[model samples]
Target: MVDRFVEGAEAHAMMDRLARKYLGSERFEWLMPGEERIAVIVRPTKVRHIVGVERFRPGGPVPAS
Candidate 1:
């Protein structure tokens, strides 16, 4: 999908409209470690891929990999 966008085979404007309609804000949560001192609402689906990749471990204990 990223490749498609980078190659201009995908229309980012159309994608953004669709995302807005379906997700109604693309809202999500993030929690900081220790004491609940900080939190955030993340709205970018693309960034989630990076975050997931960071948390993912190949051939490790987590099932996500």
Candidate 2:
């Protein structure tokens, strides 16, 4: 839930899978969790609006009325 840390075999396996996908290697011992660095994940909880606008204009000059 909150302040959670990923540990153990399953989580490490996931990390290795993600590592293979991203770092092009499965044996990245350097990527292991340590005192200075730890695996952290953040997800979007809420989405309010996805807005867009469209305006069209002619390429050529506008004709006078």
Candidate 3:
């Protein structure tokens, strides 16, 4: 899941420190928009690769790699 929050640098710095401390180095990723916002990416514990396939193929099965 990805989420964005509108906050100033202080809030962003606080969240970044907490995230780094608790989430560790591999569980998630985040970015600061350089303004007044932050973007956080929460990934699945088990990763998957789906590079090429028809994403808009509704009701169709995903292509095997």
Candidate 4:
């Protein structure tokens, strides 16, 4: 995940994106009670698969993962 703090225009843009995604409908807009907003950006990390199922079965040897 992307672990970092953001500010300025970038943060504002992100906030709008979040608002659209979370409170898209007009009915849901009421849920947004505050003028100011917070945005969070999460980047997916590479999935490192150390071991696959093929390495282990029934009584087969279990590979180190």
Candidate 5:
């Protein structure tokens, strides 16, 4: 699994790259709420899946597991 923490334009660029490389002609589905900063989770399987996205709120406490 690969994870990336990105914000602003970098986040947009990363998503664009993933869409071009992995999603191809298919539409990408966002399974989580959009935020200014986020953690992208990439999982490997038969097909690579962008399985999870974690939103980060500034000044907010980290969520407990």
Candidate 6:
């Protein structure tokens, strides 16, 4: 499953949930939370980037300027 978050706190929470559901509670391989936008990188299975609200804008450029 892909994890997308609007805030850092949410992303962190999603990461924990996903790891527990998929990789198990003791697994450390999925420790790295992607970013404001994260993707599930299951090589042989699937590789996709899950974009979040942070990556969207309302009719304007949303750069961190």
TM-score for each candidate, following the candidate numbering: 0.24, 0.42, 0.29, 0.35, 0.34, 0.33
For residues 1-65, write the lDDT of model 6, one tens digit per residue. 43432455655566677666665674335344553634343334475678774644676553343
Please report the candidate that would top lDDT against the real structure: 5
Ranking by lDDT: 5, 2, 4, 3, 6, 1
Please give the range of 10 consecutive residues that has the lowest summed lDDT in model 2. 53-62
Candidate 2 C-alpha lDDT tens digits along 1-65: 24456666656677777667666787546653552434555556775664673334665333445
Model 2 misplaced regions, further than 4 Å:
1-5, 31-43, 48-65
Worst 10 residues of 6 by lDDT: 35-44
Model 4 segments more than 4 A misplaced? 25-65
RMSD of each: 15.4, 14.5, 12.4, 12.5, 16.0, 15.2
Off by over 4 Å in 1: 1-10, 26-65
State the weakest 10-residue window (summed lDDT) of model 5.
Answer: 23-32
TM-score of candidate 4 to 2 decimals: 0.35
- Please provide, for model 3 over 1-65, each residue's C-alpha lDDT reduced to its tens digit, 9 standing for 90 to 100: 44444356656666677666666553235563554555455556677769895466775444445
- Residue pair clashes in candidate 5: none
lDDT of each: 0.38, 0.58, 0.57, 0.58, 0.59, 0.53
Compose the digit string of candidate 4's lDDT tens values, residues 2-63: 77767656776766665555556333243345555445667778866676545457764544
lDDT of model number 1: 0.38
